[model samples]
Target: MADRPEVEISYDLERIDFERTSELIRASYWGEKRTDAINRRAFDHSACAAAFIDGQQVGFARAMTDYACFAYLCDVIVWPDKRGAGIGKKLVQAMLDHPDLAGIPAFSLRTSDAHSFYEAFGFEVSRDGMYMRFVR
Candidate 1:
């Protein structure tokens, strides 16, 4: 059979079925700071969301937001096998166009190498920017 048509774009958070989503995320994420527990927690909170394709969850993104004013893009990943498919753009555009998350005063994320990628979605960094972290 010819290749099946790709799944349409959709957005969800912990609300989507978990086992499948988690399984896809496990394969998609292959970075130094990766952990199942961390991934679980990342989407478990209400502040995050994901995109599923053919029920396989080919892309994922999450944000830290108060839901009223601020949103910080935290995790954005697309399965290695699914790159060049335009899923990443659709995924992020869904979040930015979301009614629940519109009008965010600021959206923030830091990447060692994705400056141009995030820039496609209107993200920019200033020379005065600084980030601080503390032990919990």
Candidate 2:
């Protein structure tokens, strides 16, 4: 396999490719019914992270947070061709390390199939076993 290109993580909403992002999200199992308007509203309200390689977006994730108590991570997706190249990890890390989210008491996310992936980042299944959380 060829070496993966370096991934750049950015928090600037202006840098996000909304059209491509909406397409990818609408294709995802979790976001299949999501409309572009809804995505725009969500992104507008959340702290978003986008991953780029060679100036093209490869992955995206977002967090809803109050910057004091908690954060909820959502809409994590990597371009199919870019999977397994650590772009997703970088996106998640960027959200966690984002200045606004740092020191938050808890971070939570729901993933039907990516539990092991999130587990590596210290996320554990909650008592209800329906969501994963990382508590500070």
lDDT tens digits, residues 1-136, model 2? 8988999999999999999999999999899999999999999999999999999999999998887899999999999999998999999889999988988979999988898999999999977766999987
Which residue ranges in model 2 land beyond 4 Å of their true spot? none
lDDT of 1 by residue, 1-136 (tens): 5664475555556346566555665665333455667767767764555566767667766777787767767566766788777777777777676666777766666566666766777777656443211111
Best by TM-score, which number? Answer: 2
User: Among all windows of ten consecutive residues in candidate 1, which has the lowest summed lDDT?
Assistant: 127-136
Model 1 CA deviation exceeding 4 Å by range? 1-7, 14-31, 128-136
In each prediction, how many residue pairs overlap at the backbone (N, C-alpha, C within less than 3 A)?
0, 0
Q: What is the RMSD, in Å, between candidate 2 and the native fold over all Cα? A: 1.1
lDDT of candidate 1 at residue 71, scale 0 to 100: 73
